[model samples]
Target: MAAAAHDPAGAYDLLVIGGGINGTGIARDAAGRGLRVLLCERGDLAEFTSSSSTKLIHGGLRYLEYYEFRLVREALAERERLLRLAPHIIWPLRFVLPHDEGLRPAWMLRVGLFLYDHLARLRTLPGSRMVRLRTSPVGAPLQARLTRGFLYSDCWVEDSRLVVLNAMDAQARGAEIRTRTGVEAARRQGEGWIATLRDGASGRSETVRATAVVNAAGPWVSETLGGTLGIDSRAAVRLIKGSHIVVPRLYEGEQAYILQQPDTRIIFAIPYERDFTLIGTTDVPYEAEPGPVAISPEETRYLCDCINRSFARRIGPEDVVWSYSGVRPLYDDAAANASAVTRDYVLDVAEADGTRPALSVFGGKITTYRRLAEHAIEKLKPYFPGLAPAWTGDAPLPGGAMPGADFDAFLAALRREAPFLPDETARRLARAYGTNAREILRGARSLADLGEAFDGGLTGAEVDYLVRHEWARTPDDILWRRSKLGLRTGPDSAARLAAHLTRGRAEAA
Candidate 1:
């Protein structure tokens, strides 16, 4: 287990303002570069926008139409790197895009796929090819009209877990990670920043000093700059709300469908949680506070309709098992359409004459977070002249150092080591914790030894491990972010887990 000491006594080299994907990624990268880093998040790691992604790491095929060649090439290259870096959470996935002659012609899509395949030259993923929907399993659930389609490759990621693992690696590298600690304000103190951090639970505040500050607040980017730091930022971020609805399994195959809508936009219907189909992502303009965002009725209906258009098995709003919405903080490119907005990120560094530097991140995608972090640190190299060179591209994340980087082989080894765990339970634990699963199953020899069971497969041992190592306090943190067992666990599961954690804390005290 990784233990972190909370002592913000001396001046630090860097203070990261957000705890989302970009913030955590930068924190991890900066710490690996030998910087004295302190990171503070108002909520749990990946509590908001970072946790609400479509959960795929791929080069944006659609962005090619907008002439975003640079973004597409970099994202495609990063996709391969991330696949190697975290094989446990990120794995290859085949995407089937059914032919839509009216929307985009067959030859046009072929050309796009050709560009996509060749853009990232050094790749092991199979190139795209034409497929007959009638004969292939991918076309089994699709409408009969969709006869010919194309198949390409991308990768699926455990999005929230990726964020937590980055934060974990950052903490393990000597970076201070404080969850539920919000930075209320910041001001120039001498040649550094004096930031006021407040603990939400205890209503306690502390003042810490850092030579530089990083503003990576996703949706709250502008707010953090103007409201918290009283800094004028030239760049602006557009908040576009993208919502997804999860319904009962629509098809039997493991492949995902990328359906093109009539509006020139696309929606994805991917396999989710083994029991459901994850369909999503409508780009609707949003203007509201970023916190507590939910899926609107119209957006939910839009998603259902989009899936209905592609799948032979029709579904209505009533078929939805779960729904979630998140606002994408895309850099405002003055585009009239929300879907056309650039997914690329912009780093704005402010360094007035003789003043401390503050870098604000504008927009980025989950697929390019590592690259984004590397870029952020590279931009600040002048301030920290002795900072180490970049090393995250080749380093394996926590628990990702499996033998041969093969998850299946590692999982088999895990089952062999712990023969008492059920097949399904062992698989789930291995996928979630990777090699660290042994740490949770250390002394347990039988099912009963795992401790109290919460309605579903959740056990007391797993909960304690989450609290002690992953900083998971509430039931939501365990059920939603750390794992998605909330869908299977009973209604009383949260209360039970809450009681257990409360009692455990009291006992520890």
Candidate 2:
């Protein structure tokens, strides 16, 4: 079993550095194409910027003001595609863009919505339409003066879960996913490149060789290029910090709000975890190190102020329960304003006539990761001649293949099958594991059969499944990425699971 879990040959066709969305997406695509791929991440998947997003799968409506029609169109199309591909984690959302008479004019807002509606022909979701706040339920929580607004369709995603699902699919297709393994350095060796990987936990090093390499290290892209590969890359990335705050339930609706700030930037207040309203996203110029970013007091105030301007209820920094920050490694386009910088991605390939190719990816949002992977693999087609055609667009991600891709129907069936479990517990499992929920519940007829129970719905059986199937070594991997129960559980919840996991690992070893 151990031998089958790793690459015995110690070599691969592609060595992908970084386990974020793009790297995992590329590894999944390449492995599906019959390429032997190895992906190594210095930390847990989506532990950084990939998990710290606005959690929307929409075409940037604000980007239209900057005339980024191409990006908008592509993203809008991808949004619809993802809704079908991963119905378990991606769902349609209605965003209310309140007409702030002080800022963008009513006529201008109408025109932008018109363009946004017509950009890509939406099939699963409804188009945009103007609404009167006086009668609309969406405006019940807003100020009286905000009497007019426009409602449009977008999608919400389980951001970190999306990354893990891609990695799981990649591993299922014969790709090696090594978490907590950092690639210290790599150099050209004849027709391929050799890399040195250091295990974070064991403090051990091993050498790996691959025919090609992909650097999708997010914020560490430039640093990885210069420090590890010894190549001075021309590709520049602008580090812009984005932060979000989670507060108590702001309103009583499932719909989200897109607040237009006085600075012309936008903030989203979405229904999160059924108990909290997630508000956020301040775009600030960042110049510090990338990892371990946290929302500053100023950023919290800024976000609170943005919300206060739109909603009737007032909130201060004290209202914030939890906050997170991430530095977006955007491709430098020389834009004066940090918010004006392009979110588009750039793929740079370094290779001579006979040298091995090292592909570096920079600056992309979550919505277009799959398309970016397709493009990246196509660029390296000359080296991988036997690669398969793109197959991820129509294919369902792991555990997403519900009947007709209908999540509600699948949830109903899951509840009926697991009558012993609570409705909320069944729903959580269905949402997180989808069709794979049965695998975790196998041979368990009752709650006691599932073994020990944590404070929340988490159980010993689920933890064992995560460690055995997913590359979950630490409790954070299960709490934060695989699930967001970290937000609701106690601060010591992860620590409390430590002894259980340690015992389990020792018994298995």
Cα lDDT of model 2 overall? 0.90
Q: Local distance difference test, per candidate?
A: 0.91, 0.90
Give the per-residue lDDT of model 1 (tens digit) for 198-260: 999899998889989999999999999999988997799999998899999998988999999
Q: How far out, in Å, is residue 391 in model 2?
A: 0.7
Estimate the lDDT of model 1.
Answer: 0.91
Quote each prediction's TM-score. Answer: 0.98, 0.98
Q: Would you list the clashing residue pairs of candidate 1?
A: none
